[model samples]
Target: MISVPVSLVVVVPMCASLLIAVLGLTKYRCHWHISIVATFVSFIASLALLYNTLQIGRISYWLGGWEPPWGIEYVIDYYSGFVLVAITLVSLLTTVYAATYVKREVGESRDLSFAILNMLMVTGLHGIIVTGDLFNLYIFLEITSIAAYSLIGAGKKKGALVASFNYLILGTIGAIFVLIGVAYLYMITGTLNMADLRAILPVHYDSKVVFAAFAFITVGLAIKFALFPLHTWLLSAHSLAPAVVCSVLAASILKVTAYALIRVMFTVFEAGFTLEVIPATEILLVMSIIAIIVGGILTAAQTNLKRMLACSSLGQMGYIVLGVAIADQMAMTGSILHLLNHSLMKGGLFLIAGAIIHKVRIYDIADMKGVGRKMPLTMAAFTIIGLSMVGVPLTVGFVSKWHIAVGALKAGMWYIIPVIVASSLLTAFYFGRVIRNAYFASEGSDQGSSSKAHDHAHNQHGDRNSESRSEAPPGMVIPILIFAGLCIILGTAAFIPVSIAEKAAIMLLEGT
Candidate 1:
């Protein structure tokens, strides 16, 4: 009987998205205004939900007046509410960013396509966070995945198509695995509602079907999350896709998969057969360590800015998984906080990358040398982001790492301290390279001595006035500054995030 306005929170933006799609790409003049306003409204609604949760209690809404044990429901607690805020903020910022960048990256026709894709992407994200049914989660997952595949393919680069194709193949496989798991779960439990299933699952712990369902959910969710080995499609897809696409996918969707994985592991299966019967924690721990080491090392090796950042994402995911793997209250708390922090840092970094790409039309790390001096504001923003990635103090990244370190200590996994230290160093090393190139490295003879076949487009750089005018447009620059400003503001307003993350973390640990 909870009368929360959950439906309006998710539906309004989604309806607008669909409307934009129907209006067609060309004629829709105010797509930016529409998208930005929709997300902003959603963000405000989420904040209201957060306030209501603190003042009241959990919020649940039944669809069509159907009760929870039988019909679909929308549930929001501390955790879901916090994530809703993060998703909305990032989606809003990225939409603002895409307004100008999309036109520059692709044509105006494709700009509309980007807008439509973004709207659906946010809808899918909102759907995942709000749904109370297991099958509904799968449905939302598909919606998000399909939109993501289309966006990745929206890139003009040939590599974008190949990346999207591979992601399509792998994403389909992951979704199938999840669907199969959901089916097995339903077959055994005879219910699709998550709350009902959670309550009923523990009673059937000894059944083979339930165990199979556990395996399916764990493995399937891992694949969708791009945990280690299943991450092949992620690097290239993130590297080649339009910058706006990368920012959204990296900042939110992948994290959502991890969020789902944790929700299933902790909330649904924490008391089920899986935790008691298997060494799931140890397995997650080992894989996480491998991912951390491998992702960091590989990040150091990439020459392209996008690919390097993409590989770095794998490392950050590993850290989150590591926290879950450690399975201590503090570690889990750190993991959850890191999830939000990583989204901000990575999203900001990618946005700046987009700015660089828009202004210079280049992707190589070498080409970025001393260009920071030219694009001081953009590079300054990039520097803050880069420092955050390295977990520098007074940045949001540091806050997460500090919690993670404490968590590692609490778990008595002192060995992980070294891994954390080493990975931090590796992060510094690779990010440092980018910093050096951006600020100090010489412009060099490479200006006109380029061998890239794509340099033909810039052959007209002889006209200095036109080249200077090529800086990123206002829509692009404004969002970048906004995100960069957020990095500083959030970093300074440390208690706000700490309190929210702590509340969400406590919810996950103790289970509402």
Candidate 2:
């Protein structure tokens, strides 16, 4: 296996963002090229790191030659290594898709800023996954949040600015809560290092300060990951933001926040403390159930495609949190697997939404009648990924859902089985509606629907005649197909990721 410093994964993108910012002053037109190259390097580095981690058990790199508990440390165990590869791979694909999507929707004038912020976002997400220090994780979390806010605000949509403002407010509150949690942990343990805190926190587990810290962090991260009721900022931010930005936000950013929560709950505090000490998992389980049902209903209620996908994301997040709350080895494995599965599923869906809008100038689900005939390839990919979201067999979605369901059974929580089934039904209903409109309905069926959608597309792209058949550029279509392919490939080859996730789950359950 190849060897590389874990820090290099974070550094490549960070430095690229700086380079892009500096070059933005010039007439450089290849910002996307730079972004793609940087993300590719980061992805390769992450893959190599994951390979080394699997070989050696754990890989830790100290910053500036300082050891852990004294200076920043980057660690890649099975869990983080798995997540690092998934996020970086998604980042690379999104960058490639954005090459054409951004140029058309956002214009070249703003490409530089978009490219720079995209790299910064990757840097922050990578930092969050690898950091061994609680404070450093918080720092990276804030970095990611800020970049996302800017990216959303940079969108050309009417409510983009307001969406960004709302996310900024909520995200800042979450960050403050996380900071306070870290401060409390440090005050009690005299160390910010996660491993060190894990060793010392057991003694202080009964401390009210520790309980308060866990509460603050859990609530804060719950908000960050958009776990239902707190997911108010996600719909607008996703609906109004640029396509590629939405892709990264839904796919990578949200998953990383969930990862941080997992790290804190299982790694820092241990399963016994999170699951048994205070009824945290019980409370979270209830919240997750509510999120699954409510998010699905909200998704089904949307007329707009982007809004529907955004709402669906809220429900998908529930699946992840549900596994975490289950706290068993199988459930934890499912939770971690869903992190990668949901990223691929949702990321591809958003990209397809962007592609449809880009080609047909339609955002309303009602306006999607006969779109399958126009962009056959794009819509085909969308259908496959949408089915995955519905947890169809032989897709990545079903594999994770199966594991979670069986995990629930293994844990003797049969009630959750019905919740999972109902959520899947809700998912099928909503996605089925779109697929029907796209494939079965007549091409001109949208003629009777509201012209507001047409007016919006007309004003933005100046393309009034959306009846003609068209497809998104190759640059965009290729990435979407790749994501769709992975949904099936990983599903059939389940052991590949399951092998790693199982190990990570065991490590967490054993409190290693």
Candidate 3:
């Protein structure tokens, strides 16, 4: 197996990000081009790594030519390779879309710095996936978290700063928890390499230190991923960020956090310790089920379009956590499948929301009346993504639910089936309102105070909401369409993800 390019994926972006930051000082606006090329190069490297892993099995790269347990290591397996592909590819697409979107939203002066942050964000996320040491994981996790907080606050909205501050507080707390967990593990096992930890942890299977470490790591990851009850920071942070930034935050960071959660539980701790001995599966199951129902219920209560989509993410993420919590092979596969699925669908949804805001400055659901005709392509993309969100037939969302349901059945958790069905119905309730408002409503459909808001908008911005046939710029529309198309393609050719997920599931379950 090859390892040269594996290191390049992280190194290239890390170095380029520094260069981009330095370039940001000059008059030249070359940061965007450099950022896009760096991410695209990283994407190419991921493709090669995926190919190598698929052909020869998992590959490990040593840093400074040192062996594991003493030196840093980077491993590429089916799972990490799969996620790296998603992370890099989506980062590339967002970079392409962000050039114009950022120009229009955040203005031209901030574009260079934005591109630099974007590249660093991508670099940090890739580093999180490739690193194979517990301490290194925490380190990389911090890198991504800091970048996210800065990006979230980069918007012009007043609320953006508050939201970013909230995230900064909570995210730093989560990072500390992770650090403490890693230290506890190190104290007990005397090694930070994940493979070495897996080997050593079993001997201290009953140790309280090991158990405390697990608790710390899981809870920290839950908060970091914005899992329910801990999700207060996400609504404003994600909704207030610039469209491109929000899309990346919604799509990549938490998905990767979920991956890290799965890796720590199943890889570092071992399934025997996590599933059979400590019984974390059932605890996670109950929490996930709660998140599934409450997240959906809360999403339906939002008046703002972006807040609605942000809440829906809370519910959708529950599906992935549920799949992981179930501890059944099919459940694991379904969870992993949903991870990729949610990234595509939700990423597209947020991008569409951005497009809508850019074109019409409408943020409230009540303000979206008759928008379908005005921004047909943007709304069409939005509708396609929303349908997938509701798990409509022939969409990737449906496929995710089907597997999760079957996995629940396989695990004899018959009660969980109704949770899945009921969550879908609730999802339909909220998204259905958006569809009806967009397609079947009159110009006066805003009902009561929406007219007042519109008048205020008119006074402030001179008929920005006037009905028109314009759509988001082609740069923005193309990425939304690409993600929407993947919803159908991945759903129809379900074997591709199912195959990868099943392999990942088996290897994870059987590794020890």
Candidate 4:
């Protein structure tokens, strides 16, 4: 089979950011155009990488004509390939969603900066997915984090700066933990290549140094993943950011952090080490449960629509980690597939929320009453994603949960199945509140819900229509509708993601 160069996935977006700096910054209208084109190209490259990986199995490309153990390599295996496609595809769609949004949220003058940060953020994500070196992963992780910090703060909201700073502090500490872990591993094994470390780290697994490294890495990732107690920064950061920023962070960033953990647990160290030999998997399992329960409860309690969805994201992330903690074949497949499913699901939901904010300027669920009537198409997209999050059948969410349930049973952890079902109900409960508010609750009596709950836009500008039937701009609406369609399409025919996830799981298991 012919080889496909994987670096283009990163190059396309990176170059676009550079181009935007040179030409698009001065011209605000050009930012969205550059972003869309650049992200689309990266998406195409990711597709190529996925196709080539499936045909040839694992493909490791050495950088600068240097071989492994001496140079950084980009490994395109089933796991990385699957993640690459999902990240780039969502990144691309986000640009489509952002086309009209950036104009309103960031304004015309700063459009280029927003576009550059956005592109760089995605470039960092792709780098994390493809890099085979441990230290390289940390660098990419920082790149993504820094870009995210800037993007979150760029919004004109009152606390946007505070939220961004809180995230920067927490995220910087997490990055430090990860860096320390990388250094510890290198000290003993004298290698940074994941494959090389995996080959060399066995005897050291029982040593205190090795265990400390594991602890540091796991703690860092847990913070990044925002698993329950560690999620202090997630809700505000996601809820306060601009629409485009919120969608990308909610739909993509956390998932990639989990993917990085998957790499460390399954690729660099050994699957057996995580699950059987150490307490890591067990701790992950408990944390995953707490994340689900707490996130769901908080989501139900939230009065603000964005905070509710942001909290809900914490719970959904629990499902991904839960599947991996199960570490069984079917469960692992479900876990990996959930990453993709949730990205599409949450991406659609957040974009619709963005649209709601864009057109109606309301964030409270109660204020959304009759708002759906104003934005039928956007609300319809929101409904589809909401039901999916509730694990309704014939949706991608159901497919993922189904596999995980069966995987739980097959692993003799049958009791957890009820917990999964219950979590779905909790999801439905909160989303149901929104649906009722949007469709049934009377909006006339409500007085803007709460002053602190929303961004409170003034004089409602270009994105809104004065006449009857105002909806989000066409650019934003199109991406939401496409993702909504995908929720059904992927759920009904989940064979594609399931098959790829299964292959990735198999490869990881075999390595163990």
Over 355-419, each residue of candidate 3 has an lDDT whose tens digit, in order, gives 89999898888878768878888888778878888888888998888888999999999999999
The weakest ten consecutive residues by lDDT in model 4 span 454-463
lDDT winner: 2
TM-score: which is higher, 1 or 4? 4
Candidates 1 and 2 compared: the better one by lDDT is: 2
Q: TM-scores, in order shown?
A: 0.93, 0.95, 0.95, 0.94
Q: Which predicted model would earn the best TM-score? A: 2
lDDT of each: 0.81, 0.90, 0.86, 0.86
User: Model 2 segments beyond 4 Å from truth?
Assistant: 446-469
- Candidate 3 vs candidate 4: which has greater lDDT? 4
Candidate 4 local lDDT, 104-132, one digit each (tens): 86787777788889989998988999999
RMSD in angstroms between candidate 3 and the native structure over all alpha carbons: 4.0
* Candidate 4: residue 461 Cα off by (Å): 28
Error of 4 at 370 (Å): 1.0
Per-residue lDDT tens digits for candidate 2, residues 66-144, read 9888999899999999999999999999999988888799987787888888899999999999999999999999999
What pairs collide in candidate 2? Answer: none
